[model samples]
Target: MSIFKKIKGTFQLLKTIDLDQLAKLNEKIDLSDAIKNLGELDERQLKGLMKMLTTKAKKGQHQLPPIDGDFYNLDLKLSKEDRDIQLQVRNFMEDEVKPLVNDHWNRAKFPFQIIEKFAKLNIAGIAYEGYGCANKSFLLEGIIAQELARVDVSISTFFGVHSGLAMGSIYLCGSEEQKQEWLPAMQRLEKIGAFGLTEPNVGSAVAGGMETTCKRIDGNWILNGQKKWIGNATFADVIIIWARDEDSNQVKGFLVRKENPGFKAEKMEDKMALRIVQNAIITLTNCSVPESDRLQNANSFKDTAKVLQMTRAGVAWQAVGCARGAYEAALKYTKKREQFGRPIASFQLIQNHLVEMVSNLTAMQTLCFRLSELQDQKLLTDEHASLAKVFCSMRTRDVVGRAREVMGGNGILLEYDVARFVADAEAIYSYEGTKEINSLIVGRAITGYSAFVN
Candidate 1:
């Protein structure tokens, strides 16, 4: 019998039998034997016993409440259609991606087979308004990002590179003809894309220190530089390359095709986090492209900042997902793991850890929600995105650390899931913009001072 049913039966016996009456009944009959006799008793006797137990159980109904992290019922705020999409994405991640993620992550290989299945969700460029996009709100986009990262950060990164960084580059800066040519097929997963901006020598300082150079000659542009940590670049059909024009000294974006004779992308290996993402070290040696292939509106680094501002909010959402995944897994394990004849969750210290994890998770969810609201309203600024990124990434590290602490040794094992988040959190902390860089962004906005070297 369930412990709950046993407790209810004991309570019912206590209410009717005093110590003297119980002693007299015990003398007349063994409790175990009486229970067996009762089982074999007539239907009327069984009904009486069951009725007593049910009554006691009804009184104890609220003792063990359901486990739900979103205590505030934030889900109720979502539209029915949006909530359905959120559940669909969550189900997809739990069923399809969760089972095979650790193995692929250990092997550091992209699961190309799942691309077709993922595309069927029709979530790429979800918030964009045109070119076969879903035209969903930014709230839905944030939910999708969380769902993706909850299962595997690498897949989330790959999706962000193609759907957000690369496709967003076109959506925000490319000509109308370019969007019509690329966005539709790309949305359908017929053409994959990559973004190439950070170079070997220039990462956070790429704005003014971009070493990637583009020289215009004979109606063609020759791109010559190396891009490091370029996710999906090796197999991408088209790469959005950002480089400084040699003559104008202003950064410009170009649509560099994979078949270009001078373009070479080699796989970067031995990564400790986001291992399933196939980051590439790309070398451009006079990679020739027609002038028409250049991004029409990308006149300067300010244009690139617009794309980063949009996607950085998504990264914060991804961090929240990572933390939530770790917390849930740890919470479930603690309730079942036993020590000294009791559940570990019963201990005050373990509960403290769980509470702390949930607190951080709740804060992150609320912050990301507001951040997406600002985005949907078109009121989001660089400082807003940076602040969210800074806070969420930092808090995620804390949540994952507590998750690991509560799980004990199993936390370090990949099969348990929390270990991967711990490692992946490190990568999220550094990418897009480092903690130092993101903090500087907020500092500059609030203080009206530039701390970065120009």
Candidate 2:
């Protein structure tokens, strides 16, 4: 090369290193002397020196591995179209929901503005057939739940209340006429729904101890009771209220409209978790519903279990997402967060926590994958769903706890995002089915004995 060309190339190479790096290099060698010596070198020798310096400059700047929670490559099991849909939902959550999550979650408010964009996704009731549903496999539905919760558990809870519990109730138990009337609108996200099964005094034992009562009066059902912790109830267009019938003494479901004069929903406040979800304490004082609005096929708690069974699987997947989000966030933070003049991720203890988090996350993902498969095959039982819910929720708590531990004090800060996951994991652990309750369900199946009661 010519003298001018060699000097220009040398200057261009120098531009790649910042002043700090250049200063560090100068401490080791005299830069002016090095440049003068470089001019004397032959063309081949100059090229060799440039290559050596370039490699040396890039030595400490190793490329970081991508922040993916799917450690086992489970997504490879999905087809091209399925993978595309997953990416679409993931992008929507990252671009549209994630930016607003911390703020909304802290303020205990919902961002109603995203409804239009969310509606365009057309994912409600995805696993069901007809009634404007996607007729997709249950595996896809679980994956969608995971993707949503991976960003924010509150948003996932909102979607689950509307699509899984509320819509599933109408789909699995409602009459054909009711399905034609409500499913189309709900599937489009034009109408929101809520499920009301737990009450102020009823939770795990709600199956038999449900205090809500429904009476047939004048060809209509009168619902009288309160439902606590009803997600989306404050603004739901319709709520599936499960009550014991005065006549049949069996659990029945009624479609209670929000506009009913006797129907009232009070927003629950001071929540420590899932603040973005508008949980409500609903009161039904003589709330009357037409016979047409009643769930025709829901005659007992056994029928109600159908909806819970399907939704429980989704809850397990939500736990997986919650753990994953924490793991990825912590992983990213560790690599960038410097301590003792080195990245924390390089520390043995920090790496141990990350490995544990990923291991639990991977196990949860594979378990849910099989759980969904059983669901799609129509061979899933209450015990199968319960087992996954129990395992994943418990593991998620451990993962999130370690995530917070690794971050030290920043893990408790909401801005870092790990704190939110820590709190949300608690909710997931207790909500769909508590660790104790779900464990009993599985224990009953294995032992052929019901230990729920004495």
Global lDDT of each candidate: 0.88, 0.91
Candidate 1: the clashing residue pairs are: none
Which tens-of-lDDT digit does each residue in 295-411 have in candidate 1? Answer: 999999999999999999999999988888888888888988899997898899999999999999999999999999999999999999999999999999999999999999999
The TM-score obtained by model 2 is 0.87
**Ten-residue segment with the worst summed lDDT in candidate 1?**
39-48
lDDT of 1: 0.88
lDDT of 2 by residue, 1-454 (tens): 3434655788898889999999999999999998888766543355556556555445567655557898888887987667667867887898899999999999999999998899999899999999889899899999999999999999999999999999999999999999999999999999999999988886756888889999999998899999999999999999999999988999999899999879999999999999999999999999989999999999999999989999999999999999999999999999999999999999999999999999999999999999999999999999999999999999999999999999999999999999999999999989987889989989999999898773
lDDT score, candidate 2, position 109: 100
Q: Could you tell me how far off, in angstroms, the CA of residue 142 lies in candidate 2 after the best superposition? A: 0.6
TM-score of each: 0.86, 0.87
Model 1 clash count equals 0
